[model samples]
Target: MSAGRAGAQIKSFEAWDYVVFAALFVISSGIGVFFAIKERKKVTSREFLVGGKQMNGGPVALSLTASFMSAVTVLGTPAEIYRFGAPFLLFFIPYTFVIIFTSELFLPVFYRSGITSTYEYLQLRFNKVVRFAATIIYIVQTILYTGVVIYAPALALNQVTGFDLWGSVFATGIVCTFYCTLGGLKAVVWTDAFQMVIMMIGFLTVLIQGTARAGGLRNALDQAKNGSRLEIFDFDVDPLRRHTFWTIAVGGTFTWLGIYGVNQSTIQRCISCKTEKHAKIALYLNLVGLWLILACAVFSGLIMYSYFKNCDPWTAGIISAPDQLMPYFVMEIFASMPGLPGLFVACAFSGTLSTVAASINALATVAFEDFVKSFFPNLSDRWSTWISKGLCVLFGILCTSMAVAASFMGSVVQASLSIHGMCGGPVLGLFTLGIVFPFVNWKGALGGLVTGITLSFWVTIGGFVFPAQAAKTHPLVLSTEQCVQLNMTETAPTTAPSVIVNRPALAETWYSLSYLYYSAVGCLGCLLAGLLISFITGPQKGKDVQPQLIRPVGNLFCFWSKKYKRLCWCGVQHDSETILDNLETDTAWKQGTGLDGLKDGQDHLPGYNPDEKSYTNLASEKVTHF
Candidate 1:
């Protein structure tokens, strides 16, 4: 039911194409080597994880933009928009709100918390058990998905362009491992900045060429309009409707918040900034790059429609799967141009490099900060650095092994991917409960996390047991008039588009809800269950908890709960202090952002020297938190 190629062989790569592809690996590897030598870690592991808290806003912002963008976005977004209507483009409407929430509510807390792992906040607010559980959830989810991400795309690329399947997979995995192991976080962020440039150039090339071939932008729009693919508004109130305004916009906002609001990679990058103001500026700048890329994806979808308006390649059996459409189109159009196809391939691989590298780096940070350091608090700085490097190398190999395993799975990969996405809502719920609602205790948080994940998996598993009818989720009209097929002649377009219909039974209705709303469902479940449990078990006084852990929403709804005394909003305490804490008995390297928000007595810790600049020691010798 996916790609079913007709007869013609796909064009193979030329010499210039190989050169372009080779440069991507060389440039990427070079960045890692440069940083690894310049900022060699002789003391502790802090610099390896967060760039010594001295990274500039611009490069870090670019890295942030690249880290979240996977091959799925580069390959799948166009295919998604091409198959469905342009209403999918409305998903970005909520992405703006995602950035706002991360900057205002989440980023500040992580930036000042003095913790390396994002899950460290979970421990600080709730308990170590909660932190370990969340860390485990992240580890499992990231490893599984990362492997599938690298494998499936390599397989598809091989089928279309004669690229080496196992070779590309192993090469990508090892090269990423080499650089990340050698350079640490500085290498990851700098390489990401470089890779994103290649990615953007590739996107621009596709858009400009495709538009020119289709006559112009206006003509492309007209073609898209004729095929009923130019729609952006779908006001249908039905929950089962895919790509509706409610589902794509409202529901999507909630979905993205789970990622931008609390993902570990995102938190790590923001924490690397010199100041909170720099973090804010970098985040806002990141929106520009992200939105630009998405716009290309959506616009490129229209260009795909323009080229295949009458032919409908997938319908004509010229291509097998919707996901293969982009690869086919690239080879089909850019073959004669030589290096253009190579550039596109490099663009796709850039996505692979940035995403996997970032994941490996995060896994290393969390593994050491959450698991290793907790058990062995007395380790020397040199030993801690070695342990951290060893963890990075270990994760990189595990990820590669998982990629090898991915090649053996069939439809199970999709199911695994869906399960991977399901865990995010619960993770987001854990952070939201701790940061937004103070009355929710450790027990409430643990219970809510379990309840949310359970409900999410139940609904998702039910979906697999009884899949929806194909006709119910059909795409708009597509004609195959121009394609020269064996049996069919003329355009095949007699059938009307399928309309949304109500299911009869309760279970059927449950299964019918669109995947877009999954995050909302899980989040709401967690919040509601957590609130109920907190009230029954005697919620904590807002006054008892520190305000830095809580996001100050208003002078916030203090009157909403003080009368019942069920929940009370706390007031924030702000004092004047610039991070300059020195430890003589403890250790000190580059002073981290953790020392940023110290209070009256705590801010003025002993041996506070401002003239020292050393990377041979660590201040977190005890792994202390304020």
Candidate 2:
């Protein structure tokens, strides 16, 4: 039933194609085995999680880029351009600002904290309850996300190979989990680095061949322009307009913020570097890699639009889903090219594997550091490493099962955004509240978290229950004039359906908001609710709040600050008071005086204690957050 449109001349992969696809699995698993053997003796939980904080910046950077751009991006982007327009490609506009903002402001806080799990910062900044809430939210979000990642490639492979959907799911899921469990973070990062290369090669091959087959890049662009698929920017201010300038450029920034600014998978890479400076350099390098990868995807979209401008598979009903178009196009064009289709399939799964490996590894880290370590304070390093590996296997199976559930969704791309907004937005809001304003106590943060999460679900789920018809839009011009002649035939274009479907007034308005704004709405909701509740319930005194929780700069409204000097024209003076206070605390932690019951009397934890043989020396010259 999951097969492509019935009897639509589906192309099958040849023997060479299977060889290419099998190589990807072999290479990925081989790398995992290589690291597992090399680090067998030293593969402690710390090593499994952060690569012993000794990873080179280049691979880490490449890993971050690969993780961020998953299979959904590679396939969904072209489908988006081909079906809708180029406006969705504008999501990358916020990359530079995000890199600068995260490197200068967010990275310092996390890197300075020396925490393996991002949720650990929640405990450090707030309390155990808040930390647990964040950990649960993160786990749920990642589980859902991993399922989508798994399903994307499986879905694509099914279209190309006629492979069973569950078989593809199990194959990809089991293979990724094996490597992640065996090799840990180093395997994930190095494999990511290798996969990034394969990904680019795959896309470049498609771009060159597809564009040339479409009569060159210039001709493709002209055809796309003629068909109205080249509109890059929509200046509409309407929130319901899916891909407006404000939606993608402004609202989309928060989406990236949730991933790049605070997500565990990304930050784990940042912290795996030798120093905080190396982390920042890796982040900057990731910015370049991110843009390059997105550019290839976007350009491939234009080429797809041109190649399909005539044939129009969706119009001909050759493919039931827009998501299937990418694979179907690959088969239509590259079936005769022997292994090229398999390479493209490998490229898709490379993105998926890297992302899932990073998530599973991070999920294991959080499980051990935040969940298991708290309950069992005296867990030995050997046992802790095994437990983390077990969790990786457990979560991988759970995610693979969830992929079976995700098959019902309309579009993987949209499902992903909804999940991200529902969870990621509120989490980002909690971190933002903690970092920007030191007065928010655990009560306020918890209250805001609950409120934001509830509202996000109410809107997201409500839209699902009471669907509204999407706004009407003109379909692109099409002709079978240049379509590749095969068993297919030209068909008359169908008439447009009515756009306005009658629905309850509340449901109509609620469903009108674009998915891009989901993160922004959740973030703003948390900030406002947090501040309001803080004021009502009596916020913590400014002096009582730890200075480490507050960002070190941008107190422009505080003219009477005692610790910092306020400069004119939106500038901020550097403050060393927080660093000094933290150093004093660090000294206490080192001396075993206890961190005021930090980690529930686990202050002398394996990774934190300066006296521990395994703890790496992370001390460096302090720099201002400005």
Candidate 3:
């Protein structure tokens, strides 16, 4: 009789959980649809992807938050905490500085240039080869990054609710594809704003509830400190130590500099803002939000330490994998809260979908504007928009498929970061060369980009291989799994700690050095190579180059000088200063008529007609610096 009663209770709980998950899914889907309809009219070509250059500061910042959050934050942060303690938080310090620098230094240049795609700047700075190389790197990186983001949430939801993982991934992808194809940047940004709110609520709820269950915030902190989970700084100089103060501070800054300064996803958001000032404000706001989120995530991890002190997930069989730690905690918290799990799922999906949509939209913009139009000269906005939409659908499907495949790869977080590190450096290098070193020729930029990517791959793969071999030959070196499992024991398990001392295997410290460093290295490599090649190839004459190509750089540095006194400084003969001054005064450039107004006046230069052709004609001019 007692057994029967217990079985009945279990069945009832299971049924209730199903109801909650289902209701949450339906409501979240409705929210997405509602936003899609609200932004339906703005779903035109350039506007759909770039938000028509009219997105406000708040929405842009929120969109950025959603993009950066991802399943990585929800799933990876807990897993990292479970393994490495609080030192991982140091990664964000450099990121904050990078955001400030990128906003102050890079945003104005992108805004002044008036280009939709960051790759367009490559062509202006160097040659088409650099642009093509950068675009390919971005496309590859986007697909991989988006795939992992999609996979993280799906993997978590699957373990918690027993949902079909691939099906969940496909469902999320299809929804994102439909809305992104229909609505563009506005839809993505607006939806992202809501998503960011949902994610914070979900995270905060878990933190508060877990802390309450663990006997309050003070107890949680006390327990974390006792267990050594509260250690936030590691000042060791060993390259193999993953979270050292120097590595995270110096290495992390370079990583974020590549991300904020050079990456397309980040730049696309900044460029979509209404004005340079608005973009700068959005970036600063994003920094604040990012710091808050990291703090919340770190606190959540500490709370987990208190709650799970008696029975760790890896040891108890509640979660077989480290990444499943966050989901397990979520399930335990929302077990009694009706409709909350659904909301959480929606938030997770929202983060994944917002990121996917942004990438797809950006990828489409790059493809149509950079690659397709180069070959097809007579493409219309309508046609180009359709092409981009079609590509979005195709890429969305491809990414979903990749997400399903990601399950076979061990450790989703590590794989994602590694992929980023491998490719990110080279792309960063190529862009840096174009922007900072004006004299680098196409050949040098191309060679440097290739060399940088190749070197990064060799170093990364070598690091992985050497560690694995050393671990097998000399059993003293601690493997990544062993390091992660160390905290699972009630008391720190007694093992020969000296086995890891000067062992041949790669240390956990070096694991953090993945592709995040790639961009900085690639940028340096490209600059040096480009300069060397330019020395060999010789410089182009000044008169042979177009003036508009260098206008933004000139304007930024010449702010206190009269070097760019003409509005038509780039041979358009319109006094650039006057046109820029008038736009600053009237803000007419926001309406797209600033250039059109210059068509019929003394502002117009011979053969520089806007209506005669698209901006690619400007690419023909040689780039020269005074």
Candidate 4:
């Protein structure tokens, strides 16, 4: 190791490092060229946006896993575990339910719709205004998320490899944008399949190697247990308890709904499958991959804690931020190993690239389908594809530009969840209301969305702008007084920690709400507001709303029917003949209330041309599995 600028210990790169990096960029770009040329004759917007709706289980599932496990999960998860302990891993408890709920409840609806964008379902169920609101929310949230994902890995790479932060950001952004813009969904999915393998290899390599360096798995576990880092369950009833069983298992399920249930990045992959059965299979497979990746990330944190149990890096001033810990640990464990450091860098970049590609592609699809295509219904397929690709370039540039701002934020994982909870919660609520409450009119949904988003922003942004005094938790303790290797030859100057002052009581209470509760609050607020407004203005008839837009609970229990009576008693009954209404809704399902039938009452919906070419032709042509 040699001292770099500011006397920081920097790991130098070799010829093999450049070779490894070049291979990643080349393979990814090569896949783009392959797809572009292969699908030249039939390059329609339908094909570019959804992979011709003929995707298989393995590749699409792997792509979903890659997109779900972004650089935020890869980089931020280990840091979270290291700081907070094993309780952070409790998110896995809710994930199982999420897989089932999304596959059974959400996936079938989108698959049956045969629409290009997920927001199309909104237009079909309610009105164009609701759809536009959801679209704008998703576009903004995904763009901001792409920037944060790109920044996390780039910042870590800069610390370990002495690479420029902006240079690394641009490198990953431009490579992913180029491939995603040119190759469309085919290129994005295939490259994601490749990158996910690299990501798995990278994490496994670090876990196995770092475990050995820390004297094996048993010793690592013992060290973590002794340090109070292995405690998994916190049964506290306190809402402020960050990782309690109630918060992690219950509240977390609400948070994940916004990601898997309604987010375009995830739904687009599910809809790409040829049949609903294949889509379900993909969801189950994605769950298994998610579990394995999360386990690996958590174990890596334990290994890190064990290795530095007696030599705290932060206390020694070796790493400036908590997020930099894993990268520095990698350099220490694999400094002499020729290709391992390069592999680690490649792994982080892989995760970043997969997420960026998904954002760019999803944003492009939504922009063209939700905005542009509405204005020009008869726009040729060639021009539709062109507009989609052009939007990809535009969003890709915007994503990179926004990523620079993340350097000023704290805790990448928390920052991402804040954005998701604040923005995504309202969108999920809108979808949920339409699906579960058949009587919720467009006016009701729109009112709920606006109010829910308003509350979320007021609390979240207020906390950021006027933060209260820090709330403390008991982190696992460590000692570094005996550590000799981390000691620098020259002494470094230190600054005193800052003091915090309290704010008004209302602001304090607002800031005291856990980030875990943000989504739940937003979601419940929307549902309540929507229902109230629907009752006040006038609820839609059960016959008016499509059955496909309704969830299984609403379908099976017949909440709108007088026969059920129990569940429907929460509010005044809108329909007197419950049994007949339920029968009619079920009949509507049997008769096929397809996308065209969904827009029965609202005929003036902009940009919705039912006469456009159906995806059945493209699906027939590309129906082969790998």
Candidate 5:
């Protein structure tokens, strides 16, 4: 290693890096602008938010993957394997079942309900207060989550290429914001489709080249097994243990439910389909796409394990941060093969920018329709579009600032998982209760939401406030090296303490637990509390509640009845019957089969009256759920 050779290596790495990143930035921005202009007419409120309910299955499925696989997957998954082991891969298996469940059970329900924002269902099922609370939580959590996703890739790019990290962050955010503000959901979906292809191609290329360098698949597998990075199943039942088979199977399923079934960023894509069948097909296809992407990511990690066996980057100090391992590995590969680095960088930026655009689009829609419209009744459609675009710019700035702050935080994966756990659980719970448990009243739903959220936050932030039998007897150790070693081997050393501290404070594997458990906890909490409150407050005489209040619940119950053979006991036969009964009961029966079955000047049902106007006029407007 002469001085001349060393200098050449450094110079070559820098030259290739700049070329790759520059090419990626141009490609992403170009595609983004093209879609923005193409879909500009669709940028009005409804079209801007949900694509005017006209997206097809292929684009929707692609967008779903693009939305979920952020910079975290590109930078974090490989880094995870570089530090820990392969068990992290098992967390994805349960998601297969989750996709199936969502396609069959959840997507159809949302499509049939005919609502724009999922939060709108909360309003109909419970009250305005519940809807507002859920919406606020979603907006806040999404901004934070999207911020971290955007930041991670920027950090990786900066470390490898010496680009200004904050500058990269600002550039990515502005491009995403501009496109989303201009083209709305259509722009997001089309661009995501293009981006997903690039990401997969980049990942596959790395997997193949790294495997070849490590002496082909057989040799790579042998190296990984020797290095103790191949373990895929753990049967541990301990609650504190991360990435156990049981936890991955059960907990991972719930996490997917929250993400695909509840999260607006995902569900909005599904609902945007032109037909219910299209939505269901898109969702299932997304499952296949997700598995393919995860496989590519895991294979890449294993290949890296084989190639860098004796010289781990985290331990050798070649890379100061864990998340930089993947980018560094790509850079090293590019040192040998020139233009390949550009492809990988393009893929990474594609993932990051697509997610940002989707988040900004969803957030702006929620802000205008759900939050702003209530206060400013005089706001016109054109003004609403401008306002939505303005919010996108504002949020882009806020997210970039958060990225700057996150640069100083702990491991990228840990920070992201922790933030997701804190908010995802409670929100999922509220939505679950509203759809699944018809008896849950507003007061109970609200109380349950608060309780579940508080409990989840307490556990995540403070840890076991009072260590039970497990905590007192086994204090969690916080060593990064030990944690990494423990993950590779199923059996712990007899001499070491049973309670070893987990590195990253909480293992990234537990993130699935934190996210998945929320829906069950929140739903159970709301159901119990709502039931108790309804009992205490005395059941509202069927006459007291609004007709629209019963619409969503009735549809949910009807869906369950047809799918699961459950009988509804709320004195309504079909969804239509429920709406008609409520309209007659409230004297709000103006239109005959109106938006909720009370149509104008005609009451088709025998018992329904025709003069009731108690229900709000907005109920008459046709609501496109997608």
Candidate 6:
């Protein structure tokens, strides 16, 4: 077999490769054109922002999966499993709980609130300051993460395929921005659904082919087992340990809540469904989609280990970073294939497109509704749609530029994830404090948010500057015994590793908290601090707050049980049927559908007017029990 320079086959994109790659952009852009022309002249802000609240469940669910399952998950999870081992798969455990918690607790509150932006709930629950605080956090976190998502895959693909690095970044950013800005949320959703299929097929091609190359599934598992890469459970209680059972189960669930439960992208998509049941169906379908994509990612890691069992790429100096491993493997595995390489890269870009589009769309919605609409309450609805489109264009440019700039940073994979956890925890806490614990006043919510975010940043930044509190868990052994066919030089030293003396325990230091636990620490801290401040500064009675905003977990059990209902919900009692009806009725008016709203003798909210803001609390005083 002819092994080119560096023991890898010569990789280059051919005609078919370009065709396959360009097809993704063309189809995605075509979807945008379809939505843009279909809604021309009649495009209202509601139609633009939330798909007119008439989207079907299946496509929206796929889009939701694509939104959260970024290229980072496609490229990074395998790298995570390859380097750190299989304990990372424990994330699946927490995901199940996330679906249940989000569907039951968070979804009902936001869906019923009849708000375009999720942060608007903060204003209703507490005050404007809290709402804006969470909104700003989300904006910063999502923008930064989108940059990493765009740049990381481009960087890795460039290293392997000689693909233009900056060119890839600009291409993804511009194409995604163009489609989403023109097409609105419907374009993002439909394009995401289309791109999601490509992502699945591309990754599956790699997994199946790499599995066969690693000597079939049985042999792959056998080799992985022999190499110690199959170790899944680690029960260490140390918080600093990166991938322990407790950390993943507890910390992972918290992190996911920060990502999924109250996220604006997820909310906009869910509520866009035609009915409440359709929305629930979307969430549940996304649960399966996440499981499938993530499973493919993790199992591919094992397949990588099996193939490299005798000749590790990193150990042999064939790849510079762990994230490069999968791409390099792709270039090598499909070197002769006409278009599979492009398909895989397209897979990564699909993830990037989904994320960037979601960010652009969600940011526009939040900025327009939370800030612009609030300031210009008298702004016409026609102008609302136009302004939202303009914001989409603005944010799209800003995020794409950020992606290009992110190329200057070094090793952003973990830092971006950490930053997300640091911010998401507090945002999640702000909402949790509102829905689960009604006594937390605005002052307490703001204080808790400040406290939690400050501590999270302190811990995250400290870990970078400080020394290790404990050693990382041992990695499975790697080897380069069969690199003769490849051009490689061994850089790993042959000497025995140095030993450490008097290492402090993981729990001994605050900064030693694992990145996985960042969300948990921040969330728990927010809850504790918010409650203390609420008590000190006069906590409000549950009866005084709106009954619809509070859905205590304590009352979530036994729907027919009256005692738990009365005791737990703070004298606010409503059956599931009554709650869903209220949500449906209010959602109808709030989302610009007049079917059961103004016509059904429900004057609780004003009629939907295209020339006026959808719904507003022009009343300054507390207006309870509408």
Each candidate's lDDT (Cα)?
A: 0.72, 0.74, 0.65, 0.75, 0.65, 0.74
Quote each prediction's TM-score.
0.85, 0.86, 0.80, 0.87, 0.80, 0.87
lDDT tens readout by residue for model 3, 1-626: 00111111111125555575565545545665676677667645456556777778998988787787766787777667756578768867887788876876666556655566788877766777778888888888778777888888887777767777788788778876775665556667777777788789888878777887778899888877877777777676654455567767876776667767777888888877877778888998988878877888888877876666555655544456777777776666656775666555555666787788777777777877788889996988688767877888888887777786667554665667656766776776776655544455677778888887876676666555544332211111112221133335653445765554453433443433433444455556656676677678874333343333333345555677665533223332224212223223233345332131122222333334345422222322322110
The residue-by-residue lDDT of candidate 4 on 1-626, one tens digit each, is: 11122124657566787688668857866777898789877655557777766789899888888887867877888888887788888888888988988998787677756555788889878999999998999898888888889898897788777888899899878876876766767777888888889889999999988988878899989988988889998888776656778888877887888888988988888777766778889999999988988998999888888877777676667677788878887877887786787787788877677688878888887887788977887998677767877898999999998889777667788778878888888888888888778789999999999988988777777766665444524456666655555344454645578877556676657765667677777888899999999999999776565444555463356756655653442332322211111122332232222232232322223222335411121111221110
Which pairs clash inside model 2? none
* Candidate with better lDDT, 4 vs 5: 4
CA lDDT of 383 in candidate 5?
Answer: 84
What's model 5's overall lDDT?
Answer: 0.65
> Superposing all C-alpha atoms, what RMSD in Å does each candidate have to the true structure?
6.0, 6.5, 7.3, 6.6, 7.9, 5.0
Task: Kindly report which residue stretches of model 4 are placed more than 4 angstroms away from their true locations once superposed.
Answer: 1-8, 380-385, 466-474, 485-502, 555-626
- Candidate 6, residue 272: lDDT: 88
Per-residue alpha-carbon lDDT of model 6 for 1-626, expressed as tens digits?
11123345436677887788888767766887887788776566678778888899999989988877767777778877777677777778888899888998998777666666788678878888898888888888888777888787787668656778888777777776766667667878888899889889988999888987777899888877787777889888987776789988998898888888988888888888887778889989989998998889889888887777677777766676677777777877787787888888788876677678778878888888789978999988778878988988888778777876565443454656576688888888878999888778899999999988987777776666553443653455777777655422444545778875454353347766777778877888888899999999998776557655677677557467877666777644333212213434444344442221112122333322334323333222222222
| Candidate topping TM-score | 6
Q: Enumerate clash totals for all models, in the order shown.
A: 10, 0, 24, 3, 18, 3
State the number of backbone clashes in model 6: 3
Residue 86 CA error for candidate 2 (Å)?
1.0
In terms of lDDT, the poorest run of 10 residues in model 2 is 617-626
lDDT of 4 at 51: 77
Off by over 4 Å in 3: 1-44, 380-386, 463-519, 539-579, 584-588, 591-626
Evaluate residue 497 in candidate 4 and report its C-alpha lDDT on the 0 to 100 scale: 88
